[model samples]
Target: MTSEAPLPKPSFMNALITFGLIVVVISYGLFFLKVNLHSLMLICLMIAGISASLLTRCDFSTIRHAMSEGVSRALGAIFVFILIGVLIAAFIQAGTVSALIYYGLQFLTPSMLLPAGLILCSLMSVATGTSWGTAGTAGVVLVGVGGAMNIPLPLVAGVVVSGACFGDKISPLSDTTILAAISSRTDLYDHIRSMMYTTGPAFLIVLLVFWLLGQQYAGNALPSSQLLLMSNALNNAYIINAWCLLPFLVMLGLSIARVAAEPAMLLSSVIAVLIAVFMQDAEIVNVLTALYSGGGPGQTGVAMLDELLGRGGIAAMMWTLSLGLMALSLGGILYKFGFLQVLITTALRRVTSVFNLVVVTILSVFAGNLTMGEAYLSITLGGQLFSDAYDERGVNRSVLSRSLEEGGTLTAPLIPWTTGGAFMSATLGVNVLDYAPWALLNWLNPLLGMLFAFFGIAIFKPQAAPSANHSTPTDVSFKSVN
Candidate 1:
């Protein structure tokens, strides 16, 4: 139901039937039963367990172990998810988010807002190497601003996701970027450079489209009187100052320095809390409370503004965190029982030519994501599954790495059940289906990558290994769900 289920080592047909039933159940529940993702995931787990019990030869303990192993793979992401919530709360309490909105209103025209937001999210996600952080912080603020500007919420969310993922797909600091390279055994910088051929053009096109889209909203700009009201409310809620932005600047500097994300974010949160206390004169207890559960009904006194600011904190991330765990667990069951391997291996046999190989790799990524519902597993298994195939064809591993992120990282948020999709929906408050069409970069990059394969543009032959690269993957952080 949530991108993973109990697929056992049954024959291919049985595996297909097991998978199909889970999909049908999820579709039925979502389309008619109207169940939440977490609850539906639980049902999926139960269905998988029953399938395994009735269909597979594996025992009960093995099933439990499989699920646990699946969840363990996500520990790094879970750690960051918790930290991002705290960081978001600190930013809000420190008046950093308020100041951004207030200042943005003063300078940015309606026609420029979407483009600006796209660029802003791109920079933050690249700097932080975390799409979740960008979405939770900058994405939240932009949603508020976009709402005030009368832009469609879904469109704003799509732009935020597109930009956030663009950076997550290519940033040197990104875990997905690092993971893709490591998985394909390609040099990190080489992988980054190779992606430029495809991701670069795709992102530029996406930017252009968003710029054009911005023009349509030009006439729907927020009225000066209403803009003044929101700005006044922000001013009244907290002390808006240039100095309040220290946390963000600090985070940016640390990320650029490649000091791992966890410590950098934690340190930035501390700075934000201190600023909130000293500069804004917020109560220590209130600030701490906000850290745990967000500021309730922000003091803006305007319903819309109040709703925008009244977000963040550990509690807000719980739903996303829980869904992520369930997804992992479901993926684990299928993986442990060999369902995923059986199906993917069946598909890999058809790769006879370079173009066929490219198409298969991309489809395998989608297949792995759809089956496991976890991009990390998709990339990992995809790398393991297709590494030799790329070598046999004389293509460089960087291309394989590029394909992995192009599909695994970028499209993760397009699927409603994947953690990336779930996180975007939970954080940005838009359905994945609603934003998928507008998340042009996320979907288009893969097509462009495939186009390169069709023409043999940047796809290079294997190179001799020589130089010592220092950029090893130290932080096995979240899969960009990018």
Candidate 2:
């Protein structure tokens, strides 16, 4: 048998070609006709094959080997995704989330409506470590109430999502927050504390905007009788007390202590389950069932309580976990093929200054959100790409990290196909595009990153300029606003 010629070395041009082919295939598969995920997977494999053959000048076996390695690396993240789902499901089954909502609704009225709604959603999002959960639960009800009060759904949804996302972005227990810290090798609590500098401002601005809107929409207080009616409606649905808040407080405290995310969440889940059993006398078998579907049999007479309480199980997380793994696998293939290296190198060549670097990083993250459709990818990939650049320039890692969070983590929800976007859409019944503009934090983040960079705000580093001739600065003083 004749021996085949050796493959050529991969180049930027080849990487570009590979990326183009992948993009075209995805666009065609997703848009041109309805295709199942299996078909999509096959399409990806075929595209990878063609790209490898032409771009890498490699044999099918070599390409397959790289692809297998890439797919294997994603298993860990897939498991975490499943656990996150289980945690959410457990919280729901235990009536932890419902109890919080029921108590909040008791105080909501036309007078304190806007601030209360914003704060309530923010609190829920912070408690759950998920804006999607907050939006799906309290967000939907707020919209219904808005409609009842003859208010605009889009505007209301916008405020609700804004508040929820703000909480998610800042909350220490947030998955995105955990991912950012881990990806950047920073302490989770430190990162969260650092984020508060910008997050606080952003949150205040969003609240103020919502408050002004409320002034116009919140016409008059629902009379005392109506308030009482609302209270009765809440009371009739579910029993509420201090115990309901324990799981959230425990989770938040653990998170603040910089505890590992999975354990903290698991512990919180356990507390929720125990609370449900002891306080609510929730059925154990029913709790197990609800962990998958995000729904379980609640009380028959109380529609609101049943609907609110019956949500989020392990089954609910499967789709997200599967998609996350698939994206990771695809990303891994691209990385192993040297596509990411080529892209980063090309992007880095143009960045001659901090301003440009900030801009590029922001754009790259937003692009990832648009492409990969997930905040975790955006934060992780952005950190991977930009961390070294920032370090070389004598900039603090926190600056680059916070920028990634602002650009990548918070903005994924604006994309319709993104994990956050899909979760929010499914939960709130609001189109991604509909609330995109109103998601003040999402849009403001990149702007803040750029603004901070240009203004030299909060960028910690050695005072000496970076130059080959100059000796390295020995005294490193870390200064952060938070």
Candidate with best TM-score: 1
Best by lDDT: 1
In candidate 1, list every pair of residues with a backbone clash.
none
lDDT of 1 by residue, 1-482 (tens): 58765543667776777677777877787779988877878888887777777776667887898899998887777787788789888988898888877877788777888898899999888877878878977898888888888889899999999999988988887888988888888788888888999988988898899999999989976777888888888888887889978988888788777777788889999999999999998889999999989873256778867777777799988988888888889889877776667666777786678877887888778866765778888888888888999998899998999999987998889888888887888788788889889888887899998888999889988988825754534434434323
Tens-digit lDDT track of model 2 for 264-348: 6678888877876777676877666666676634453445445544545666655555554555456555656656556667889
Q: Could you tell me every candidate's TM-score relative to the true structure?
A: 0.92, 0.72
In order, the Cα lDDT scores of the candidates are: 0.82, 0.64
* RMSD, candidate 1, Å: 4.0
